[model samples]
Target: MTDDREAIVPVWTLATGDVRVPALAGDRPMTAERLTELRGVLAALADEPIATLEVHPLSDKLDRGRGIPLDAGSPLAQHLSQLITQSAKSSSVAAKATATGENLYRMVVPAKTAAQLGQGIVRPMAAKGVANGIRGAFVNSKGTIVDAASFVPVGKAAAAGAAGGAGATAGVAVAGSAALTVAAPLVLMAVAVGVSAHADHQRQQAITRITELLEQLHDQKLDDERSELDGCRDAIDKATAILLDQGKLGVSLGLDSAVHAIGKALAAADRRLTKWENALDELPEGKAVEIDTLTKSFPGVDDDGGTFRTHLELAGLAIALKRRVIVLQAVDHAQSDPGNPFENFARALKADQQRLDELESSIAGVLERLSALELTRTNSFRPVLTTGEVDRLMRAASRIRKLGDGVMVNSRATDVAIDIARNKDGSVVVFPSQPA
Candidate 1:
């Protein structure tokens, strides 16, 4: 292992499923110093405003009092479906529907979950085994990959090399010129479309899986699943909103990556349909199903199903990825002030700021839509929270349930409950009945 201080590098480790910081690409074990440098990079990313938009596509439309029919297939209809989902998911709602058919603002989330949501910090790290790599979790509005590194455009290098360097003067240019000629522009464009669709589809998969995972998590022990579920939920909230606000008919469907991989593949098909839409005259065979999906307003396609909303989330992730890539690349242009570390830090800080700004804008929209739904919490847990140091025993009870309504999950009054009994002298106490 070479010392990481020697201009440390990152490599993807297939065996450990992580990004390994190394002295060089092929080097064995990474030096402690390189690991430290990589940690800084991970820390920088962790500090980003982690916002994910989750679209709640309606399986059916909410009928207006004066309505003849409310269409679920329409774009605006889908937006409303998501707003209802947010409020419903909050721990505030009972299993029963709104008996009054009334709608108002509600803060839906388990009390503890909501409390945990005080926008806690996130820290990114590499998993072990593979080369240097981060989890491909962050996605854009278009459902495309959003990593710090994407393949750089090859055109620039090709052009730069042809103009100058080595033996351009010796007509090394002629052979290169013929090679470029042989590669058809249309063929390359077609290939790009296929690659774009595939990337979009994979992103969809991640979104669906994660969403389905969240639903299942609610059935599990709270202690076992709260933290991970919270993270996934936040991602969905942010990703869904992005797609609802800004998505096109075909090329960009905002779908989540966790619960819907197949949705992405279909989206890939949609992309192919879009690419050939302009030039169907030249190539018009073997696309009957894809063409039908676009026609008749995508009838019988179950667009409002989990399979459908998943695509919307992926599209949103794709767009977000593009924005992130642009912002990250922009940082490279900043002239670093070596004497002032802040200069380099400033570039990174600015990128983070831009991301947060985007998140704030998205949140404002989501809150606006949700504000109309009445998901208010009628009751909640109250604990004596003091500014001064509190005993560890007290800390356990200090946790407040999120989205606390009238009901309590494992109340002190109920059997098989746990509590941190505390004494007046600020010591531990045990009670036969737990405190509510």
Candidate 2:
């Protein structure tokens, strides 16, 4: 016996779908209201069972609200409706309602049946002006388009139809010359629009990447600046601690005072030296006659009486003795002179000037060391002072302290007196005595 068997096929299958309307063109996005209108139009034409109806908004997810299901007469429609209504009432819907690219409407039917519905029902509705602003396509389980259609704008359709009819007639009349001119601009405009869109998309992506990179660089630079500031603070703290520990906190101030004192001393010594120099210059010219008379004078008086020869000899002898006595007196005055004011002033000036030079040199050395530390801080984000650098700075502090001590000793010495005694063997002893 021969038996006839029928093959069974799955009712529900996966399909790729897209539905774009006129509102999605240009800068306009698919808003909620517009999506509802499109859904209503699709619902009126959907006579068969639809498995799912997914609506993707053209706008970003943040702007698009909760999803709304199509009010189609299907088994899943009531459950989807309830879910959407609940989601709309509550603000905390975790699931994203919309996506970016395309909206989908699927039917749980055989591929043949879906294709028939698209051509018969959907295309008829488009022809009747119900799907006027719609453009869509449906793919089968194999990811191939089962059916697709686009509702052309009335103006574009009319222009296309007119151009086609004219080109057909002109092809025979002008030997295609008139047709080429008319069609060339339209083709070129379409190509230009496509190229411009592509270029604009690429430019936006490049700008986004560049902006991200710039932001990263800026953040890194700020971090480096902060690190540099931290290093500077640390360096300053270390330097301060070093100074405090060495008991040289006021070294700079002491040095400054010493400089001022030395400057004053130098000025006073300069004045005294000038005065003594003037006195020395005047002494030679003003005392010349006195010196000459003293040279010719004698110590003894004349003893001869009345006779010319005897009186002359006695006068010569008296003059010779007086001259000798004058010479001896002058020698005694020079040998016992207390001090040469000119020499003392010159020596004091030289000593004070030397001290001034030493103080200035110390100041310069300190400044140079500080400058080097500053440059290191300036050039690097995080600078660590070397052992040599720390040692140098410590040495500077020591020198400054020594300078202060020397100044203090000199200042005290100026207010005191020293007595010097010579021994029999030419050795000398100095005893410092307080001023009365």
Candidate 3:
């Protein structure tokens, strides 16, 4: 069974009976409201048994949040890379979702056999396949196939022609189009600052700028849009106030609170944007946009480019503003965490920044794809992607690219290796290791 729709709640299933669900943020105990929400999300995916629901974490970088072709090069991305490589099956996508993008991995497995795959029980599960199921697990998000050298089923000749010189050398023997590789291991120099009145002022000023930007971009058209921006402003204000009031003694706790609040706001806005895009997708005019594909040809679909471009424009403004605020909140903070707090902070900062980068890249990819479609068309009789749409997309991509490049601040030069250990129950446990 193939499903190609985006859902607010991300759900994935292993061929095994086990279904993966979203873990509550941090160690927060589940509340009735939270439980209710979880139940609703689960109910939405009940039609397919053995599913996994995970929300892609939000980040300060732009390219992070949007789902796209998978990166096969990064060590961190290896798990996903391996999953696709082993499975020969496509469909690992991070779906469009509210607050943050959600990923729904589709696996072809029987409902009965208790396959322990995708549970992270075994490091890089591909080494050991399920007792009875496909060799590799399948993953798809929002109708975009994960394109990796190892994932493509076709041989080299076909893949080479399809990729059209877009392929990156992954050193793996597999057929595919251009491969997206992760940037060099991000070296995040952790920083620890003693909370000072001056730092507090800087925070306030930063928050004010974010609030002003929110005000400037405030969309009065939809209550949902307005409310999202308003909520973001309030969250920053209240969370910042709490963080400052906590004094140096409680700076760690305060920063945590602030990050959480800001992240929530950003996520809420993202969700709203996703909903808006979904509505746009339903419109009769615009053509459907697909970022992941093997061939250079744009797929033919009845999708509205005007509405879609507008959605990207709005999202670009809103997400960029909030991310700037997050970057401000993250850098040069005093944290009381154990074991080289600076490195820890740097690691966290890098992760968030990378997320933003991924998001921006995805946006750029969308615009680029659309722009290419407009340029490469069959007939000159009234193009499907109008000139105005192409121009807007190009401008948006340029602006978004600049924002993504400049988002990171105070990053250190050395890369740090992260030691990730899984508990007996298959929950991942991450801690700092020495620098790589």
TM-scores of all candidate predictions against the true structure: 0.19, 0.15, 0.28
Query: Cα deviation of 221 in candidate 3 (Å)?
Result: 5.5
Worst 10-residue lDDT window for candidate 2 reads 152-161
Q: Count the backbone clashes (under 3 Å) in each candidate.
A: 98, 5, 41
Residue 121: error of model 3 in Å?
A: 35
TM-score-based ranking: 3, 1, 2
Please name the candidate that would achieve the greatest lDDT relative to the true structure.
3
- Taking all chains together, the TM-score of candidate 3 against the true structure is 0.28
Alpha carbon lDDT of residue 415, candidate 2? 13
Worst 10 residues of 3 by lDDT: 118-127
Better of 1 and 3 by lDDT: 3
* Residues 227-268, model 1: lDDT tens digits: 322233333434433322222222233224322432343355
C-alpha local distance difference test of each model: 0.25, 0.24, 0.30
Model 3 C-alpha lDDT per residue in residues 1-436, reported as the tens digit of each score = 4442332322222211112334322222333245334334542433222212222222222222111122223222333333333323322232122212122222112211111111101111011221211112222433333222111111111111111011111222222321111111111110111111112222333344434444544535533543444344444444434432222323433445545544664565466445544543443344433322211222112222232333444444344444434433443242334223223343444455555444544444444333333222223366477886566455544432332322222222221122222222222222212122
Q: With candidate 1 superimposed using the best TM-score fit, by how many Å does residue 411's alpha carbon deviate from the native? A: 29
How much RMSD separates candidate 1 from the native structure? 29.1
